[model samples]
Target: MSMSALRRGRKAVVALTTALAVTLVSCSAGEEGAGMGEQQGTPPSTDFFGYQTNSRLVTTNAGTAFGAATNAELLASRLYPAAFVPGPGGQLIPNSDLVTTQEITEPSPDAPRKILYTISDQARFSDGEDVTCEDFLLAYKAGKMRELFGSQKPLANEISNLQCAAGFKQFVVTFNPGQGERWRYLFGPGTVMPSHAIAQKAGLTQEELVGALYAEDPYQLQEVARLWRYGFSVTEFDPDLQLSYGPFVIDRVGPDGEVILKANEDYFGDAPALEQLVVWPRSADTQRLVEDGALQVLDSSTANPTWYDRDSETNPFTLQSQPGDLTDTLVLSGYGLFSQQWARQAFAACVDQGRLAQVSSEKSGTEVAPAYVHVLRHSDPLIPRLDPVTNPHKKTDMELAGQLAGQTIRIGYLGPDERLAAMVQAIKESCEAAGVTVEDVAAEHMSQIHLEIDPETGLPTIDAFLGPVDPMYEYGGPEALIQNVSALRVAEEKLWEDLYDIPVSAQPRTFILDRSVENVVPYTGLSGIGWNMDRWNINEELAGQVTATSEETSEQ
Candidate 1:
């Protein structure tokens, strides 16, 4: 059948399902009446539904450049499992179910840099199609050509070639000379998609899609790009277009911003513990949701610590927190007043970072220390060896900031975060002493503050952003930061000189889970609790409820 025909059929099924749901509701209402009393039999089982807070009701998980961390975890990660996933204790481990061998060759005078990835034969999409080299090729093409593909990662540009056949299970990517070591980073997360699905959406065969990517056919690639960029939207979700190869596939996106995921029976790896998972959008009424038993788990990053009462017996959730990989920092913009190094340095010098850290700690209910270097983490071994003198911005220099007196510095933070607000207030107070006015422009999302350019001046709306930064992706260079302690220190020193980012305090990660959720481990990495969500199960016996059982699903 044609893709269009399949989509039409799915739409018809959805319409019929909606009509049937209404009929079921009407029938359910009459169950208390004598005539419908016989219709009632065994009570329906309460399926496992996991909840996570998303800021927006409608979001697209497509395009790695602009994908959100929440969508990456709750939706994309499980829907399209990456080759390497975040392991316990901040480690990146290969997915043994998909990847068999990964080899990297450094660039030499004799040979070009090459990275080879061999996938296991077991790797297959939810639709029973083999996860092939064509998918990786499309990923590479989309990531490399930013204008056409909407990818913003710098790692894509380092790749020179992606050598593969259409249905080959392996692909060798040759990188440009002097490029950094990026094996752990490539095809890791939010990069790979089912090429056949995209091809089907674009009204072409998988072979034709491969040819377009290799030939760089603009018109044909645009059709592919159109779907690749905007097809996986939650609001107008298409099950046929947004098929998952992982353990779970999206069942439906609810009207109230709840995303329902059902286990994929076609998955070849370990079966998911639960048959159904639901991700609820984050809202101010989170506590109410917990109390009402609607929310089972919350894998949150920016949620305020004070919102929940940990001791309350009425609430079914317990809040767990740890220091996360993302550090809350003042990210300077490279336009307007901040264009000058002195202006940037002066602003950084005036802001009391220690006080900012203290505020973050106090607000977050976590013991956060001031970070001096931008790149290195607080737990790094190299931090002790680095001279304190290397970081000169430890003390606030009012004299330096006085030079920019009467100038207004606008700062923004994504969403309404309490810690970020406190840090911004601290900055405002400290900078106010030097006659510099600090403006707080709280943004609904990251793009509003970072990417939205003012037409008149062509500068970002906010001069700096008070938020979290993943240093690895934010400050990647030709050499990997993890090469050695010395290299790490050098990178930190270079970042210090630039003043592009002023380290405030490490972000406190938080998770709220009901007692029914079992086998969950707190991870400090990017994916949070949802990293191994497939392993998580609801202990229904303990919670006095029966869980709905389903057939075995796909692997992630």
Candidate 2:
């Protein structure tokens, strides 16, 4: 899902290729205008619309839509900012335009581990600022080391230090012993911001910010944290502060939640294919918009969740799909009525994982397996299976769940899709049969609960929520899966307290492309579906047809 160069489309034919196979841009001047051009086709637009249901486009991947389709990496690789790009089979592909080479060293026997990245001098931000280690430091502190600023705990907490060894072009990342096994992927999905712009916004010199990063100054960190957390939001998008180091930069955010990307003429890398790219946040009517020629790419999230469930082998649009790495799974909150471990266990035992997989996949017309682990894929060998006598997805036992029938437990989730809606109802019905009350809660409210401690009660606010549980990466291997015995015990208490994550289910992403697109490849294992979208081109014949229709409609 990385469009960022440092880390990590479709249509027409029904060609079947394997999924392991797997983009352009300018510097400063954007297109004259940014519009979908569905209104009329006379001066037909080369503009394209890419849709995704998840609103989150950040790199932390900590909130709801954790690995949501609109990942910041996906946008960065396709636009301007990028570093060591991910290639086929999870290989690190360095962007010659930015980074020169990257190397990992274990250092001396007693020294800490390190990953050294040397950048090309030609790199420059859209604002004309030189790409520097200061940018990386900002991303690392704001995202991976968030605890320094009293924010939500950061992911990838294993990285001990990140600093510039020489000029801004060269940087070094030191890993904590027994941590950061996946150091190569550190900040891979994230891009560096312009320290100059961020510093100006925070009323500090770029040098001061860089110094603050190195010293971890408590006072300066608070302001840096403020800018890092909210500076790039759609509502708060600032061309100056949220500057682009990638090929494409944000020109404007539309009232309709449309993010229009214009080329950065100052970009040192390859230019973007299409002059104007419009990202359309997915909605129920997204299908109608594409069918009506208002959109060109069904390249993001599927509203139906079953949009790929076509019963036939051939689909109207070109299709590319691979078994994805991120899992869309459910999480039980350790709050309110679920404070008791047995209560969470009882809910797990009653819900049918098979039913969830069945109903959700019935749309793609393709059946899928259910998930059953915390940090490992259900199909991974290291995952402990829970079938036979230990399985929890069975019919509810009223006698066993009679701990309390009078209280209600609210379940939280994101998006407005039928799949989740169906799962929620199913979970409620199953739990009700076991004498427990269940309610639905939107994921937004639950995000606060997951990241923040309530000042009033000093505990998470929500009763329970459904969110994606990232696979092992922050920690070296699957060891984190079963790490702390005491923590595991408290999690599974009820002696059985050593386990808390009730294994539910996981689903991979299925990509549907429009009939008029090309140069799109499907990739498996983490770089998600759109690892290479910057090079995607449109089919003239099919594209022209839509233009003709638009022209005819306007004349009428």
Candidate 3:
């Protein structure tokens, strides 16, 4: 999905408005025909669904957890429906499944970019409490203070006062100067804590309550920061404490490391498609469960040909892929002998990106695009141009790299994983051709390498540093590359003017799924295959056909 399509509140309103007049029709025939039905077309049972991952959701910290735990939170975000939800095409579409309507009116282009939003009268929390303007204000205030669930501290810096009118149906929020572009990030996804309840429980004065929720005072700021770090561990949900407003409530955590969520029939929107959602820690053995018919959906990361092509007659298996927002890059540190522009450029020019991508695909089971920009946004300049076939800028001279000999270049790398290691080895060989001896260093020990250059001589203590580069694709746009390069430039003030470590390609998260799964939606930054949890469903008839074939073979 494109980043522009993921803005939760505004983009959703825009997409639904445009889609209102159109109807989507499915062309599939046979048992895969559209509309939910059994045998003759009945909606699948809304009792249980199966999903598998390769890690555990141990931390509730949204900013820190980047693996399985983060995926779990995303899954929960769908079940515990937020006020706004991302749509199928990656547009933030209303969870008409939860919220009825959320309308926003902004001033004309001639006026300031401020906006006013009005909530639907039918909106209510899962607890049956009317979702008033105050609720939004409270949510915004908590989010801005970074006291709400899943809040990012950097996002809290953009919002201003969020005030609800006395009638409770109208509310207004203003943004800080220069934050107009960042409004979406500020109010994206997070839990809405009950403001009245929290204030009453804390027994604070109105002034103090405002301060705590808005963090106007240093004490309140510190307290909210503490809660932001450690709030989930507080047992028991009090009205003042954070409580989920989604379709499911956290029932009990399992000793076997499973999280059980039961449907909240009182949910304000349409009841969830499932009665229960049991999330288990991700495991490598998850494929066994699918083979045994216990799991209906498994991420492509874990699906091998053996399981993917499991006999439908007996195993009833299907396959599919979920696209994600992961990017892998080859980063060069500015500290080493590589601090020289000629040295870095020479190295970047010699490495063959096409071969590197081929090796990466073989090892990572993902299609490695040669460009540095993500495949989805082909126009974004973040992706570097590196194909020897298409790139006219590729270095054609090997003798040029020979001048940097005797200067040892250190390259940092993630691991001995397939794509990265292969790329590193290829670069090492290429450097050898140029007469430069390259040393591979662990990425963890990057800080210890002090290869500052001598300003007078314009030569580094060490030659160069190369490794895996982790860039923030979610927050920064095309300028992300420039900013990354600029930071290196600023730190190593005397280094060459040219950017070190030209980005070769983005290592994106790829999901492979059974083709039978319909309307599968994948989110960005999602690694592994289970990113689309609720959307996965099976075509039982196709499964049965596969099963039958397997049974006949077993009898023989």
Candidate 4:
């Protein structure tokens, strides 16, 4: 179906749903899909259904987690922390539920920059503990310069100090000797770890945890860092240790790897309308499940549908899609032969990014464009390109990479990804011709390739891997501060290599949602679909129908 025709069809769905009142769905295992009662056609169940990506909902390892720590966790974190949450329009805003006042001062010669984050006395977690200044301090220290995990990401790094008033609600952040962008945005949507909970888990007093951050005591710091880095893992999620301050708290991690969040009745802010929010993984065909009403939001990224295949008219909902902020690229791990700048540049030049984008667009029926640099959002004036872009795919550079003949560069990718596979194959064929042997290491999933390794080798069985070339870290976010990442380079054994990203295509997040659901906002943040889930509402009667079905399903 044509794009315009599909959009017009959505008009009809909007009209039909105008009368439905706000409603939501619930889950308790064995009672999920039966939410529509005995309706022949799956009537809009009150449940507000959405989707999740690869089962990695909590791992911090970039290779296996798909960056979920920064993305998916935002949904749960938004409830407790009031500093920042992704707004409906893609900008960061203070969560009114927790934040009472947010002040951003203009930069000047005398006092360059400043941000004040003040949470409400009413702010509290699911367990009824008050949200305090110490929580934000924990996030700032643990994440700012990677003092804990021994990695260097410039997030939450700029503040010279965080001074809090006696009550601990009003916190003032003072800048260091120089102003930093990561410092600018960190306060915009700052993430806070539960200081009280972390202290309890680490067997330290609340005073000790905050004191450790202030004193930078190696002994106490290491204890806090251990939990921040590895404690909240979804693989071995400990509900008690992973307490939440959000509107919904994680009740359990399902056997199938779904993160199940139950309503946090003790929450300080307005309770979320939905009692049970289940972020489920797509088990089989996504489009079919969405068509059957088993899924409410069909993420285009996971569905991997092309433009021509993007149809919303025949369905009962409006397809709301906006450009995603991610770019497709081949990130060459600068390990072994790829460590040299010449070697990295030579192989990067040979891969036909334009051709790769074209092939992908044709396969997915979407328009694809080639990216020349890391940061491509025309919206941000930051990171102005200094060089002109030209294609090497049009002309071969066999002579350039000929220096590394007979060198085997192992390239790994998520197996069965048709689009990625195509890009990798093109890269493989091009690199191989230049005398550099390209070993394509395909894995069933990201964990298989990234987390697992041969013991004897002591190296990632592969030399290089392919994934999104994060432009933000370079000039996008904190990495923009300066390339002073030698500290980070030393932490990771294999990931230390200079990253060489060859931009392939610009892929956007697309979604098809039921008309019965409201406030469907498209966001370009880490929490892709759930960027504005807090504002999502459903139809009242439909929710009742879903509840009845659930009760019935539970009985059987």
lDDT (Cα, tens digit) per residue for candidate 2, span 158-209: 6788877324678878877655545554555434556677787788877788
Q: What clash count goes with each model?
A: 5, 48, 39, 15
Q: Tell me the spans in candidate 3 whose CA falls farther than 4 Å from its real position.
A: 1-48, 60-73, 80-84, 96-111, 119-161, 164-170, 176-186, 190-209, 233-242, 302-315, 321-359, 371-473, 476-553
lDDT of 4 by residue, 241-272 (tens): 66666677776655555556677777766667
Q: Give candidate 1's error at residue 218 in angstroms.
A: 6.3
Tell me the TM-score of each prediction against the true structure: 0.79, 0.73, 0.58, 0.71
lDDT of 3 by residue, 319-355 (tens): 4433244444444546545555677766665666666
lDDT of 4: 0.53
Candidate 1 per-residue C-alpha lDDT over 255-363 given as tens digits, one digit per residue, 9 for 90 to 100:
4556777888888898888777766666524533332234567866444544454553233356776777767777777777888899998898788978887887787
Q: Determine which window of 10 residues in candidate 3 has minimal summed lDDT.
A: 1-10
Q: Residue 511 deviation, candidate 1, in Å?
A: 1.9
User: Which stretches of model 1 miss by more than 4 angstroms?
Assistant: 1-47, 54-65, 69-71, 104-112, 147-149, 203-223, 300-309, 312-317, 335-337, 387-390, 452-457, 477-483, 544-556
Q: TM-score for candidate 4, please give it.
A: 0.71
Which rank order by TM-score, best down to worst? Answer: 1, 2, 4, 3
TM-score, prediction 1: 0.79
Best by lDDT: 1
RMSD (Cα, Å) of model 1: 9.7
